[model samples]
Target chain A: MEITAIITALCLVLGSLLGITGGIGVYRLPDFFTRLHACGITDSACAFLILSGLMFQTGTSLETVKLLFILIFLLITSPTSTHALAKAALNSGETPLMEQQQTQQKREER
Target chain B: MLEAIYGASCLAILAVMGLALLRAVLGPSAFDRLMAVNMFGTKTVLLISVFGFLTGRPDFLDIALIYALVNFLGTIAVLRFFEGRKTPACYDEPAEEQKE
Candidate 1:
């Protein structure tokens, strides 16, 4: 019981910290792609951590089963949506900042 | 002790949600807002689950699942809406040519 508690605490705190950091990144990042990466990291890592912690707290039960389902669904959907969003942006001709910077650098070199 | 942890986690989630809200409001483009909203939805799932545990009712997990499904579908639908507008020429041109 004690060990589980300790682990749960660790997971919750670390996960939420990652989440907050991701939120800040989303707010501060200069472009859509960078912000998407930040959001992806938080969506996967933080969700895994928090859900796992909750799983530990719940022990063997139907709730734990539900948590696991949520985790799996999140893992699958978050990345797919991120990809779709990026693709849509690309289709719309939104050049990423990094690509623009590289082109500018090459022009300067020339 | 567990209660305190859950409480702190809830507070942290709330702060993160606030940041997401800021992004949603200040996003320069529709895609940016969409991404922010998607992220916000993910955070909401976590918040709801944490709250459920805090309140000693794990049934909220089901609601989180429902939210998760809706968020995914919502993003897809909105993105489709955006895409449809982008290339309406191809979608509408053939019909117009036939009409003429």
Candidate 2:
């Protein structure tokens, strides 16, 4: 009984740290691509860590099973959503920051 | 033990939620707002699950599941709305319709 409690405590701490770090990534990245990368990391690694910890805390119950299911669902969908966003940005003509600089350089050359 | 975990995680989620809200409010473009809203929805799911865990109830997970469904739908709806209506196949069939 005591060991399970200890484990749950550890999981909670680790999960909280990851979540916090994810939030930091969201704030610190500069451009859209960088921000997307940060969000991907948050959704993938941090989310898995937190969800796994939650599963451990839940142990072998049906809730734990549901938690695992959510983890898998997140894993598959998160990246898919990221891809959709990037593609949409591209399709809608969102210029890359690097390209914007290049275009300016060409204009200056002219 | 459960109470402590619940309280701490809830605080962390709230902190992140605040950050997301800030982004949503000050986003420079439509995409940024959309991305922020997506993050907020994801956080809400996590928050509901944690709250359910806190109260020793399982139904909140069901709510999370439903939210996930709606989030996907909402994103799709927004995308279609923003993309505007496609020109449709019949629009290009003016030559065929001319005979009718």
Candidate 3:
């Protein structure tokens, strides 16, 4: 019983932390690619952790199946969407600072 | 114990949703807003699943799945629209700057 309570508290604390960290990442990250690092972690990993705790409390049911699908969808789409966003950003000339510097240098040489 | 655990997840999920909403409000760029909207949709799926589990409703998962697909499609469409244009398309800015 005590173990269950401890686990519950842990999930609560950890989920909040993940949520807050992701928010900060969204706000603090300078670019779209960097933002993906934050949002992707929140979607792929943090959601899984939170969902697992919820699953434990849910007992065995079809709800589990749904959660499974949610996980699967998240795993597939989170990265795919991030990749799409990243590719579009790159195609539009959004590069990391170092790469931007390299491009600038190459431009000066021409 | 079950209620408490599921409740916590719901609350945390809401917080994440709120964060996404904030991004939607203060996106600084069309892409950031789009990311924020996508984040909101994914968070919504989790929210529905947790709520269904809390209430012992199996049918909700189907709705959640549909929601996930719609969210994915919506995001892809928005991204493609922006991609088709030479700019971020929504913000009318050059270079698609986000944050400082």
Candidate 4:
């Protein structure tokens, strides 16, 4: 029981650390696409860590099953949302920062 | 030990939420704000789940799940709204219209 508790604690800490880092990335990243990468970290790594920690605390139960379901649902939706956002941005003429830099470099070369 | 862990994690999550909120408010572009809002929603889901465990109320997990569902739907709807408003046909329109 104590071992389980320790593991849960570790998971929570690690998850929160990832979340904080992701948040900083969101705040400080240079471009929209880069910030999206930060959100992906939180959406995937942070969420999985936190949910698994909660599952450890709950043990084998219906709640655990539900938590697992949520994790799966989140894993599926987070990326889908990111993709949708990126597609929407691209469709609407939001050129990626990297691509812009490359085009500028090519023009300068000419 | 568990209580301490829960409390610390909650505080960390709150800090993250604050940063996300800052991004939402200060984001330079529509999509940036949109991404910030999405990130905020994700953190809120985490916060709710952690609170559930902290308070010994597993029922909050149900709430967290609902938030997750709502967040995803909300993101998709918002993005779709943007896409519809700025369809590729309008690509030749004024830059002013695209900023929205």
- Point to the candidate with the largest DockQ: 4
Q: Which residue runs does candidate 2 get wrong by more than 4 Å?
A: A1-3, A102-110, B85-100
> Please, what are the lDDT tens digits per residue for candidate 3 over residues B3-94?
66667778877877887788778766677887888888777877887787667764677877887666778778877787767756446444
Q: Write the per-residue lDDT of candidate 2 for residues A1-110, one digit (tens) a residue.
A: 57766776676677667767767666666666666666666756656665676776676888887887777776776677777777676676666778888999999999
Judged by DockQ cut-offs, is candidate 3 incorrect, acceptable, medium or high? acceptable
* Pairs of residues at least 3 apart in sequence or in different chains that clash in candidate 4: none
Write one digit per residue (lDDT tens) for candidate 4, span B1-100: 8988988889999998999899888757778878888888888888988898889988878887887777888887777677667554343334656688
Candidate 3 wrongly placed segments (more than 4 Å): A2-13, A97-110, B55-59, B94-100
DockQ of each: 0.48, 0.19, 0.48, 0.59
The digit string of per-residue lDDT tens for model 2 on B12-51 reads 8888778778866766555666677777777787788788
Model 3: per-residue Cα lDDT over A1-110, one tens digit each: 66755675576558657866886788677776688779877776666766665556545777667767777777788788878887887776667656877989999999
Tell me the TM-score of model 1: 0.90
- Quote each prediction's TM-score: 0.90, 0.80, 0.79, 0.90
lDDT-sorted candidate list, best first: 1, 4, 3, 2
What is residue B11's positional error in candidate 3, in angstroms?
A: 2.5
Using lDDT as the measure, which candidate wins? Answer: 1
Model 2 chain A lDDT-worst window of ten: A43-52
Q: What's model 4's overall lDDT?
A: 0.84
State the fnat of model 3.
Answer: 0.50
Ranking by TM-score: 1, 4, 2, 3
